[model samples]
Target: MSDPALVTIPARRGKAARVKQGQIVKVINTHGDQVVDTWAFNADDLNEFMSMEHTRPHIMKIMPAVGDAMLTNKRRPILTFIEDTSGGVHDTIISACDRYRYKFLGVEGYHDNCTDNLQAAMGELGLAAPETPCPLNLFMNIPVHADGSLSFEPPVSTAGSYVALRAEMDLVIAFSACPQDILPINGVGHLPTEAHFSVD
Candidate 1:
């Protein structure tokens, strides 16, 4: 069969789709710098979503590598990393940026953030995320230092590089082309860009 059509996760926005067990979801770094905050939820139960804290100990790594299974809050495998051509750099510690984060950064008004983007994306599918668990920050580069500190750095992924994850269970996958222009997480240019994904 032909390849599935690409779905666009618009710049500074979010998108989500459903995938069946054993299917693969390929997320593309379309512009090279955009950080896609990704999450997976059990289609039969939204309460059990992918949990970074749970996954870290389960996989024994801060971030997943090829063959690592991302676990849910209940500690069940949800998605498995099958391929990665984006330098294998991702983040699992940082919480999704929210309106409160912008406020803390001194923004007087509203700011688009990953937390909101996630809900909006799911809302489009007539669903609601019970909670915003820490996401698998795709292509996000945050360096942990020897001093036990962390720094938000630009993504190392080049344009069109992608990661392929296979669904371990029938689930809904959500992604936010993170709208974090105030930090260098996306890039030193502080510009958010669009991303793409395909389920097969």
Candidate 2:
């Protein structure tokens, strides 16, 4: 087992996480208040991208648990959940942070949105530039209300809790260490989070 420690990477504007065919990368929520909206695509084909619409239904309304497999739009396995200590891995509800959302949420000043990071990731991988969409918000706490409404809440994960995933394909994983100030994930402060990758 790898040691549990906080590793901080400088936030590059448009760089993605490029992992080889059989490598494992872990994104840790070192600080209790942070959210990371992530997406994955085939390293060779841009069309083969992660789809929340396809994934949400397959998960069968239950939030992702430890050891659950994440599927892509083509029904290809992307990543398998290896650790989920928070017990609040919300895969369906929270959308990726973008510029339009920033304006709508009264946070227009923050141009360095999640989409930028995703685009950067793609560029780094030498993949075709594609329009970004709603991404999977990891470590984010979005609770479902009794009336079926969703409310963003403080992170359920503590300072040291983390979620791990094993890549099932040669994937280009793009993530935005979400700079969301309007939401609670960053404690309403839009603080940056830490990330680390290692071969298992």
Give the number of the best model, judged by lDDT.
Answer: 1
- RMSD of every candidate to native, in Å, equals 1.8, 3.1
Query: On residues 81-105, what C-alpha lDDT tens digit does candidate 2 reach at each position?
Result: 7777655655556666778888887
After superposition, which runs of candidate 2 have C-alpha atoms over 4 Å from their true positions?
1-15, 108-110, 188-190
In terms of TM-score, the best-performing candidate is 1
- Candidate 2, position 141, lDDT: 76
lDDT digits (tens) for residues 1-200 of candidate 1: 13458999999999999999999999999888889999999999999999999999998889789999999989999999999999999999999999999999999899999999999999999999999999999999998899989998999999889999999999999999999998898889768988999998
Q: How many residue-pair clashes does candidate 1 contain?
A: 0
Q: Give the RMSD in angstroms, all C-alphas superposed, for model 2.
A: 3.1
Position 65, candidate 2: lDDT: 74
